[model samples]
Target: MEPVTTHSNHDEPAAASPIWPWVVIETLTSPDETTVVLDGASPRAFSRLNRTSVARASATAARMLGPLVAECASMSKPRDKYFPLRDDQLRRMMTIPVLGPSGHVHAVAVWVGGVEEPLPRTPIIGAIEWSVKGLAVANPAAQYLFRAPQGDLLTGHTIPEMLAAFDIWPDRPGFLSLFNLENLDVAADQWSGTATLHYDNPTDTHELFIAARAVGTGPNRVVRAVVTDITGTQNPGHADLTLVAVRAMPITPGHAVALADLKTGFIHEWLTSSPSSPLAAWRHHNPEFDDNSKLDVVQTCFALATGVRDTATHEVRVRFDPADDWIPLLAKWTLIGGGDRPQALIDVTPLAPISAPMVTGCRMCQDMANRNNAPHQ
Candidate 1:
């Protein structure tokens, strides 16, 4: 916690200057939220450095640090405020509220010009810096959780790599929602949720509760994430229901491909909120679309085939690259005549390769299910 850089007020315009006076007002609120105890301020001797009132300089801290506290509390977000000095030099101030895990406002950090560095790290907490490129930094606790070396910095490590031993439960999109910044507006409104990852090996799964806040501004912004492994605390009711669907739809090789007449050799449906279909191919290929989209494609193709034929069957080989491994699917479409609006029934199943391990369901989730179903003494 170094003091914010100060500038000379000698006819120099502070508006264009990058450095100015700043203070971090720390407080501890009572349980009922009626009283606020000013714990202390970072960058000691704040009042003396700024030449403010002596009464403002309490033994613990300089109370409030001028009007920045009141103004910041009123707005309830980080914003810049411009102040015109006697010499007509405009000073810009930005207030950022620091919130605890429970969404309690612990402190208000006021910067005179710009933020020079990221927020102070809580060494004991599992924290990481993430961007679209991948993980940028992993603190001590985060390193331990992700199995990275204690002193090693996380550079270019993707989330999949960090959790390589786990299968992201309910697919990647559900897990990624925890890190989404769509709801991030203020410090307290940071994106946070629990994501379950079933360990691939013969071990228990993990439920990671993550709180991610967008730090910095514009293109330079990165996510500041705090992670907690809540595996032991999560309710069993939170079990991924997608696993049950996967178990129900077993994969089998197709007998023949008859509906090749349909364009793309796959079904296409415009469904968006459909439950994820049991598609084993996506986990390995990392397709651009989720299981739901893949299922929609399968359904849409069936619809097209039913329009022409009474019964049709299609075998779809999905692969982005010819050299890459592909997923085969068998879709059967049956047109039931005498219906009000061309009613049809469709069945979709993965085509398993000869002498290959079952690929119909998530291996990790299926393994856990088997163990849970085993009879106890």
Candidate 2:
């Protein structure tokens, strides 16, 4: 790969700079938990860019380039996923790489964020880019989009060399990326935007958000876009904003399947740590909650369980009683397992629509339900 652009700082790269500095080794000495990858900040933050730096590279440098080793030692194996560094201060970091023909790292990129923030799969493309790898989409129905003046879409399943296939749309029907594009051209190398699209009905769609950054100054610059989902709100124009109390009884033998094995662990964890929990910290900045908040959470889960529906076909539903008018959308999703293991996906769909409020009492009823549901994080 040709250099994207020459840099003034010969070794260390600026945070937003397209320049990537990585150690391309025939192999790492020991690619294990003790792999001594990048540690905390140091006065000598960077090593020399000499040809033999691979033999003398730092753990941080080795980790920044997460390529399969060319030669594994007796105890080592090929990496199935990214590495986890040992740094108490840093919550998480991921090293994504572009591999060459020999399956060695040609370029490297890194992302660091807090534990609460989900890891981003945003593409990192540079002018000196490699072939675009097909995205590992969590949901098969997810719409992959490419930005252009007329709003272009990249066809799914097939990996395109570079991003040449960014605008092949309508060729695949039913499979679509719904977005209301306000900006046609993204001027910055790094930028993010949200698009609101209607699904099922014009009034029922949710927002699709993307944050992307380009890595190269040249034409081959790879563009990485990270996508995430946010729960949608009711459109005040189409539907009347009214309260509804969904039937709070558990699913019968006829309509729904049993709740996913009540996470005995969550219960166990809760039981063992009741008195020890920081009640003040939990209620801080919120006067609405008191010492009984934890107990209220247990009650709320029981009530929400009424809305939890699992079909005979292994479909799942977690419904809010007074939700906005949204058509039942059945889709398959692969949720994260304990770690890399992929959990079995459920065919999720709503058992029934909230047609109307079963019973609408005074403000007292609404307040109670809100408090009951409040303990749910």
Candidate 3:
């Protein structure tokens, strides 16, 4: 039997800090049900017993491995198991089923403690291996972040699939581009950025700081990512507006218009003084523009940003004064790029009142009026 080698010297006092080693072993089980240790720097003291028997070396492994192996077989993916040792020590074991080119598990890789230390859930960390087959390996933390389905793992699923399933759409322009795996290479060592994600359930939002680094080489290289929820650290109780559309001033200023500019434009274009104060006003000024309408706009904007749609047109009813009848306006929205900032452009044109009859000869005007009258579902 090979001697178990570790940095901790046996001559050192047992009272000295103990260095725990995690070992990997072959999957073959003996008739006695003992596992053969392939390699690891195990404690020399523990080696006094059967050094090659992983079950004899660590009581935690002896207990956890049997059940974990069964889970991997049934689920077709590895699951993590954690157990505690004496002296407030925690041990985490992650089993990886190594699949051969034929899509069969040829061997198993058991990664034990010493890597994932200081077991705190906050600022979660995970490891992933990317390849042509999508995520070849995703740690349990990564599975939780992507909201993997119960009894199923994140392995074999693409990033976009997980993002859509969890309703974790990127909140800013060009944010989704970062996940384009084709752009990543061995030369690309690290990535760090802040991403805001909008959740559909109960309409919640989270701001996350993500940092990742490449730890291995080739197409199947391992990348470790750490995500920290920084929502509370930012301005409290306010959603950051991701400006999708910006209207430029018509004159020489040529700068994007602000909210005040919108107010001024309303007065100049509609020939009426603003009725409601700027603070009390909302966009479109239509009673039908409720939470659902807002959500539709958000989804449409995301779709446009992600290349799902090219252009979307709608008819909006607006009124400067509450007492006055609403004015029908045509709004056309399209994605605009090739500038420092990503933005969309909207063209709004005033139309005849809905009560008025459309021109008999004009097909476009008839269709526009018909759409304007159609009640939104």
Candidate 4:
């Protein structure tokens, strides 16, 4: 039996601060069941005994070895000074010291549960050794090392096989080359002409064109390819002229031709019976006039040409009717890609008779009166 060390000394006033010591205690009532205790001590241990007693009240509530040792070490106490016990008792206690430097016991503790057994050692040889040995003694002729074909590792398929699977066969001669080595080295070269195919729906028209510079090596090698729909002229009645197409021509000077120019071209051919001449006198009468007013005649002419009208107040209004008399004239000469032409002479008609308004100040009235009153002038 060894002397049990205690934390207190009367000369030191017992350092009344609480001290938590980790110790495993074998109870006499249950010899097999070990209990761990967090013994709280102070210079005067009795002062806080009741509060500390609660931690030791039950089996489950007992402090375990690891945490108790940690708590003791955190307080900077020596294990032997706090938990001195015999070697045989310590062995049975299965206590492991949470050691600090050179037997300076930081904490004293035993496992409340059974001690964890040490794991057995295992021997392992790494893959690098086997790889190095295989590389050193590999025979080129026997093993076909460098000569073996390179391929997709997962699918184990060579380049030619992959191309064949996709129905791609090399049309150019000497497009694919292969090399083989016995021990560890192999190489292959491949070249091919590239082309792409496309199918368009709805229009059912096919247009193919050269897309890129020549590919592969030789006269018959494919360079590039493209396909498109060529159905623009196929359907007789289907013009495919949406409002978007009609509006695409810009009103800018350099970029777009004026409507006046369109009237001079072949557009007048479709609007009139005589392709070479303009409209006749009877055809030029105004609906409002018994004898066409000069204003009405001028208005009808301009309205026929540009799909716009000049009001009595001199403001211009756009005429949106597709069935207007001059629309046919404009449409006929102004074929889709025709360039610009003059407006006045494009579809000129003989002036009709005007009566009622004799105003000379208004341009519309003057123009209409001039046409009616001055034929030679």
Top-lDDT structure, candidate number:
1
Q: For residues 174-215, could you state the per-residue lDDT of candidate 4 as single tens digits?
A: 222211111212212222132122223334332211111122
The TM-scores, one per candidate, come to 0.32, 0.21, 0.29, 0.11
lDDT of 1 at 248: 41
Alpha-carbon runs more than 4 Å astray in model 3: 1-124, 132-136, 165-188, 196-200, 215-218, 235-377
- The digit string of per-residue lDDT tens for model 1 on 170-211 reads 333333432333222112213545555554444766666554
Q: Assess candidate 4 and give its lDDT.
A: 0.23
Top TM-score hit:
1
Predicted candidate 3 versus true structure: per-residue lDDT over 1-377, tens digit per residue: 01222223222222224333333322222112223223242212112123534445456555566656555534548667655444444456666553432233322445545335642222333334444222334666545554555644555544333333322223322232222333221134545455555544645765554444443444555443433345555542333233222221341211112221110011101111222212112221212333444455556555554567767777656553344465565656665542322345555555653332232333333444566457999
For model 4, state the Cα shift of residue 274 in Å.
Answer: 20
Model 2: residue 289 alpha-carbon error in angstroms:
66
lDDT per model, in order?
Answer: 0.41, 0.27, 0.40, 0.23
Query: How far out, in Å, is residue 299 in model 4?
Result: 21
Go through the candidates in order and give the clash count of each. 4, 13, 0, 20
Sort the candidates on TM-score, descending order. Answer: 1, 3, 2, 4
Lowest-scoring 10 consecutive residues by lDDT in candidate 4? 125-134
Candidate 1: worst 10 consecutive residues by lDDT?
Answer: 266-275
Q: Model 1, 2: alpha-carbon shift in Å?
A: 4.2
Output the better candidate (1/2) by lDDT. 1
